[model samples]
Target: MKRIFIILSLILVSAAAVSLNSCKARDKNVIRIGLNAPITGDIPKVGEGAKFAAQLWLEDIKKAGGIEVGGKKYPVELIIEDNETKAESAVKASTKLITQDDVMIIIGPFASKQAVPAGGVANNYKTPMVAPWSTNPDTTKNRPYVFRACFLDPFQGPVVANFIKDEFKFKKAAVLFDVASDYPKGLAEFFKLAWEKNNGPGSVVAYESFTTNDKDFSSQLTKIIKSGAQILFVPQYYNEVALIVKQAKELGWKGTIAGSDSWGSAETVKLCGSDCFGKFFSTHYAAAGAKGDTKEFIERYNKKYGYVPDDVSALTWDSLNITKKAIESTGGLTGDIKKDRTAVRDALAKIKKFKGITGEMTYTDSGDPQKCAVIVKINNKGEFEFYKSVCP
Candidate 1:
């Protein structure tokens, strides 16, 4: 009887110890990552690319046995929510990420207009958000917790406009922009201002606007063709830009065409086909001629995803890496997140020269990166060729 009692007591103690160990394991081994993107909407490709890159980063981190934080290594767990390419959906997604999931940091919703509303949520919750490719200057302005890895439209717009003026020497230009897209509208305005400022008066001959869902651009193309402009600037995304270029060609309006970083995608070639040849655009980075860390990223991404990554994907990876580095610098989970976030924000702001897959980055007080833009011109082979790099 004494022996049986002793065995029972030992078994009870063992079970209690096992339960405690399980609780500890759960608490110490998990870190949540949140992604708010338009996974099922008109701009699904952009969102899909951002989510894919974030997942790739998480996989790589886990493969290396997770990140060490607060004396414990924790594997990353991603929580992705679709924003449906709407501003209201973005706000809802961000609120869920902060309130329910309790994510330490959040990635993006891909579009500038979406970023504007979503960023407000991050600011309200005091959570850090690293945007992948939202380029509107207003996206990060006055939002303490919001940051981006891509060049803003203000910077990119002037750069491309100047390129058209100086390199192509196109004196008179026409502009066709999407009124619904903050990116295209903002960039179009900047480009027009810069063109007029550089070329003196009457530099902009035709300025036209189209809605996002508009398919036929023959009317706008006809006006641009009759304007006697040497160059045409289409500040819009790949889908609309491709359509416009194709329609312009169909209208027999042949001139130097220019675009913004939104043109940096393989779909541009697929959509415009031969019409995109000889067109030039300013972008953040390109996979071709990539070396060092960029080369490694390309190789790993291709091996993992079975295709080449675009500039948005590359920037998404860089945003994660930047966040990881910032968190690591704060000594993992040891410091208070609010305090650590400030430190991380400061660290990011003070980054003078850091090589990223997107290019060299150095953030200013406004949280904008001082970096070079890559100029790409489409060749007759329907592939983008490196033209030159413009430093600001």
Candidate 2:
């Protein structure tokens, strides 16, 4: 009886050891990255763009036989969590990705509203996170572990303000933005400051505001038209762009309508139609006449998705590649999630220059890129065409 009991105990111990070894092997063989996106709420298109871009990147990774790090290749797995376009959900997603999913890095919650809060969670957990489309300064401000793939609103705001002043020689401007949203509200303020600085105080004739989900802008339009503003700047998402532009025109406003990077989505023209044509906006890239890698990416994405991929998609692609470069630059992972996260974060901070499909980026310790912004015009055919380049 003692011999039988001894044999059973040995068998159980060996089985336990095998299971433990298998778990360790699994962890070492695959790299997990988290994607926190608004897949279902106000901006599903943004999430779709992000997801499609990541998938295309994964296909390239597979073709290369996985990502090579320290002379060895490891497969990558993306754990996508929908933030539902809410700040609370974004925080929850970040927490889950870091604590439960054990993701080595995180990407997205692209909007500043979500990215800002999610960034705090990722920073607290010491995980590296990159926001590809967020332009708000707070998204990466003082967060060592958080970085962004796009320029900050402080830069973008002035770019647009100066563009309007130079292009149209306009002295008076009007601003209409979503007061409840972080990206628009923050960007609107920056633009207002820049405009006023150049044209003196009170140059922004009609600084109007609206909350999110407020479709009717007739009251704001009436005020703007009466304000004698030369141009109206609406720093809003694609969905709201169409409504604002169409409504402004319907109200007999003759002034030009301009926008910010939020107008980079393909849906902007699709939804706005003729109302958006001949309008200019500041964006990350221009797809109508792109060359080299940018052209190739646009072609591939359009062929697969049946529409030109927007700046969001292009930025997301670049961000994923940047993440991959950071991972490989680490030489190898130590199989410890915490140690690996720190290594990747350090590697990312050290990347001096990265040529992305959108543009070239030079990183500093602040985690924001020093790059130029593109001024894009919606041509007669509803295509986003490159108008001018503004550098800081």
Candidate 3:
């Protein structure tokens, strides 16, 4: 009787262990993707766009019965954490996503200010992160795990410089940027280098700056106009873009204004109104005259969201799809988070060419994509029209 009792206890213990292991295995059957966006801060519109686009992508994944890997389908979930558009906030958000959420991959913190800091956390944690619209080179510089969906400022700077020189025939240029911010500051320097190389040394007549959240630009505009600048290049977000452009015009500065991808937001023209009409800016894609898949995305987003999608939205969509491709290309998940994340990162690095709705991207060693930049003209209707394409 004693022997039989002992045997029954051992059998029950073995059954319990098996049940526990089975539960653990079942827990690993779902893939979690993290999103760290500025959902409630300075650029809430950017955050809104990222969230909306991600949800749209998630819908597609669900429709296909989740993402398939190695002939097995794993249900996917998105863990969204708002970064609030601050550098420190981004770091904390990314850390939580990696350590607590245990996400396979992270996407967003769109602006360079947030993306740069968040990237460090992701890289240190050995998690893959993709920034949808961060154009600063430092966002991916020396960080193998960090990647961006947009062109770097090094490429964008020269593109803007050459465009202004060739199209407008402008020899003297003025630049107004936010010194406190990384994106504008870096692009300002690069543009200056490119402009001086194309024209002559000291060709940039005026280089003025302001800290973030400064509404008045009369002081900078005054200096720029006094410097005999024929064009004013403002590489700032939509909020600052409208203020700078309007304040410049109000101050009796009559030179053409040009912008960078930051101006591609729908709020730019809306805030600046007729003041922003007939301006040109360098961006990822133009929504006014899109075709094929690009047009389809824009139409669907507009119908569902009640507004035209911006470059950030398009890039986020592309980034998620790229993430999906990389995850699917991992052959199979080992039910180990670390191993699977490494596999996804490796697959992403090996992806040389990907056709995105924005453009075709060829990944480089540093994980930056070789893609073309589009010059968009803000027409009379405040619509972003495709003007020209510049390639690297």
Candidate 4:
């Protein structure tokens, strides 16, 4: 009889253990956020910063006991994919995240060329996406599921043009753009129109183009130099920017070189060496003298990592927080992932005033962030110094 009782108690204990595990599993739920980055191609730093920033954001969320939705707290899970800095690769990565991984939100492929194609694939599944660095206007066009954290090329281009024309009095400007890249090409086009309109017609001294694989910029820089341009604007990536600066300096071109946010990487200085000093670029934020949330983020990132966070890092951090806010605004994820996803999309669209580490952003109805741009100068120390802020 005692043996029979012992067997029954053992059976009860086993059943109770299984029940406890089931309850714990329900309590320790998770929501996956997909990150598509160009972690292997020409501009790997962009992706590296983004991935690091997401990890930092996740750490904070975990400390806070995860993101609360519908009164249930869920630990945020990040699933990162390498896009290889190409549009086709971005499409493949984003498709996998949407279909196979079943992530609710996806953050970035850095540039517009990749973001546009990735955003298209995300649109089909009604998945929410926030591109931290993409500036091309076409990225969010007619796509409600897609959003960006940076100012559009049109918005930022005029800021750079007006700053040079109004503040620096640089009337004669020239442009060197990558013909194959959408961000640089669109920024160049916008800058040209704004320069001519704000400064004067024919103010742009020369317009030059290059491809992404082109290493020899001497041919293009020679034309820009011969045009007697006081300000040479090269709205290209940091890799190409470094080459352009090195080649231009080697050619004895003494003009003030300016560029877009793509020039915000530390690789610019490391690649161009001493030639990159004192140049200027328009970006989302300047970390060296940042204040408020920006200051706090830079300090924390530096403490955890070995270096300071750049524009892309801050944007990626903000995008992750923005996604978290959207998830929470939906009252937590519902059992129906489809309905909850739509709710998250709707919540994101309604975010008009979002104060982030970068700056205060007001999202327009079209999914663009209505924010200002900051011009940063590379000091003699190869550090980004906050020069000035331009608001629209």
Candidate 5:
């Protein structure tokens, strides 16, 4: 009888121990947000800027006693994983964040290449995600759980095409895009459709494609030059744009150069130097003519990071605020992860009038953001000068 009593007591003690440990395992006052970023790769600067900007937001929220949810507040804990600038790497990082870290939501993986795979993982697990700087539509097209902070390429491509036509009064445009990559290809298609539809069919003088990692654009440039294009639109990354501009100059085809946000980078100036003068790209915001929230953002960012904020930093900063606002609206998690994710998705769908520092935005049913695109010229000082602000 004594042995039975002892066993009962042991069982009760073990049960109590298990309950206590399980309670201690969860804080109940912390919300985990996964940050999937390319922190260690070719364009680490973008990830560095994004991380720095997010840290600033984190500090602000911490000091404010965390983000409010259902009339209460929960401190957010960020689980950052490096995507390493590869789609396969992003898939692994995103899976780890969702399955291992059990993060409630995710932010980042800046480019579409990273966002596409990371978004795939997020959808596979029913995790809500927001991409900051990725403009490709495929990132969020069919995925209701995925959204974006910036305008889509469909919106931006038209903005650039119209801006070039209206402001410069030039109609003959040429597209030289990286055929292997989706961002440039998608933008080129959008630009072509808009340019032709608005200005007339066949306004585009030339349409050329080049594979990725192709250093020589002479053949493509030769085609564009021979086609009599007044403005050369190369919707490619800054590195590739720099090379194309250099090669174009070497080929002695001196015409106006225009591109999309992928061309907006300090490194573009560093690489192209005076060769990029008078060239412009459609982007989020520029430092020299910023105002209101954008001005304050640039000032604060410059103070913290010792440099001006780029679109990646600006959009990442806004992505956090947008997510926090959605969580607040949805009251964030009733302990049912699946239902809570759905709630977050519904909240995101209804997110309108979000006054982000990037701009006031409204998320459409298609998960596309309605936002303005700012055109900035690379001045001789190698700084982005505000040229125009185009609104939808």
Candidate 6:
């Protein structure tokens, strides 16, 4: 009887041990990441690129058996929400990610205007958000939980303006911007200020604004052509910028066209065809002939997705990697959600001189990266070719 009782106790002990092990495995082997972006709409290509790159990263992590968090490996699962290029939709999607999906970290809503509202939702839930390409300062301004891997518009605008003045040696310029986008409008104003500061007053011959959905830019292009401006600056996204360039070419506007990072996309060349050739723009990174980590990412991305990565892809990859670094540095999400989020936020705020596939990312007090900007010009082949780098 005594021997039988001892054997029964051992069986119970073994069962309890197995149950505890299973619970630990479950706790240590899964991480949920939220991806919120405009996957459909006028500028769906950009969001698609970002989503594709992020999915590729997660796939790679899975193939490698996932990431090591707090001495345990966990597979990453990406939960995607399409914002449809609407701010209200972005907010709703973000709320779903926060409340329904319960993602601790979010990446997304590529446009600055969309990011503004989506970021607000993350802030309300104390979830850390890393924006891949929203350059408007207000996206991260006064939002401690919000962080961006890309440089703010103020920094990039001046960089492009200075490059135009010093590198291209342009004195008289014209401005064409999207009035509806905070990214373009804010960047245009900053570029104008930088142009005047570098050159003399009244250097910009013409300043024009257009709505985001406007396709026919013949009127604005005609005005710019008549202004006798040597260079034209269009601070807008790839879709509209491509259309504007095509229309501008049709209008016989031969001035050099310049724009912000929003012009970085594969569809830009496809949409504008030969019209976009030789147009210059400021961007974060490029995949063609990229070296070091950039080259590695390009190779892996091509192998994984069967296509070359773009600026948006590189930025999204960097954003996710940065978030992983922050979480790893914080020793994993084991504490209270609020406290863990604060720790991750603090870790991200202290990121300095971290080399990323895009460039070296150094976070400021506002959680914007102070990094190098690349000047890329569309070659005659309609491909973005590297020109020069500007460090900030």
| Cα lDDT listed for each candidate | 0.82, 0.93, 0.92, 0.88, 0.86, 0.84
Model 3, position 46, has a per-residue lDDT of: 95
Model 4 spans > 4 angstroms off: 1-28
- The alpha-carbon lDDT assigned to residue 153 of candidate 4 equals 92
Total backbone collisions for each predicted model: 0, 0, 0, 3, 0, 0
For each candidate, give its TM-score against the true structure. 0.89, 0.94, 0.94, 0.91, 0.91, 0.90
Q: Which candidate leads the pack in TM-score?
A: 2
lDDT of 3 by residue, 1-392 (tens): 99999999999999999998777443688999999999998899999999999998999999999999999999999999999999999999999899877899999889999999899999999999999999988888899999888899999999999999889899999999999999999999999999999999999999999999999889889999999999998999999999888899889988899989999999998899999998889999999899999999999999999999999999999999989999999999999899998899988887777999999997866769989999999999999999999998
For residues 1-392, could you state the per-residue lDDT of candidate 6 as single tens digits? 99999999999999999998676443324677899988998689878888888887887788878777688776778899999988999899999887776676899878888998888888878888999999988888889989998888888878888888887798899999988878889999999888888888999889999887888888888998999998999988777887888788888887788988988888788877888888889999865568998988888877877777789899999999998888788777674555766787888888777889998888866668888899998899777888889887
- Tell me the lDDT of model 2 at 43: 86
Q: For candidate 2, write residues 136-233 as lDDT tens digits.
A: 99989899999999999999999999998888899999999999999999999999999999999999999999999999999999999999999999
Question: In terms of lDDT, which candidate is stronger, 3 or 5?
Answer: 3
What global local distance difference test value does model 5 have? 0.86
Candidate with better lDDT, 4 vs 6 = 4
Per-model root-mean-square deviation over C-alphas: 6.1, 2.8, 3.7, 6.4, 3.2, 6.8
Clashing pairs for predicted structure model 1, backbone only? none
| Residue 277 lDDT in candidate 6 | 84
Q: Give the lDDT of residue 33 in candidate 2.
A: 90
lDDT digits (tens) for residues 301-351 of candidate 5? 899778887788889889998888888999656866567777877888888
How much is 184 displaced in model 4, in angstroms?
0.8
Cα RMSD for predicted model 3? 3.7
- Which residue runs of candidate 5 sit more than 4 Å off their true CA positions? 1-26
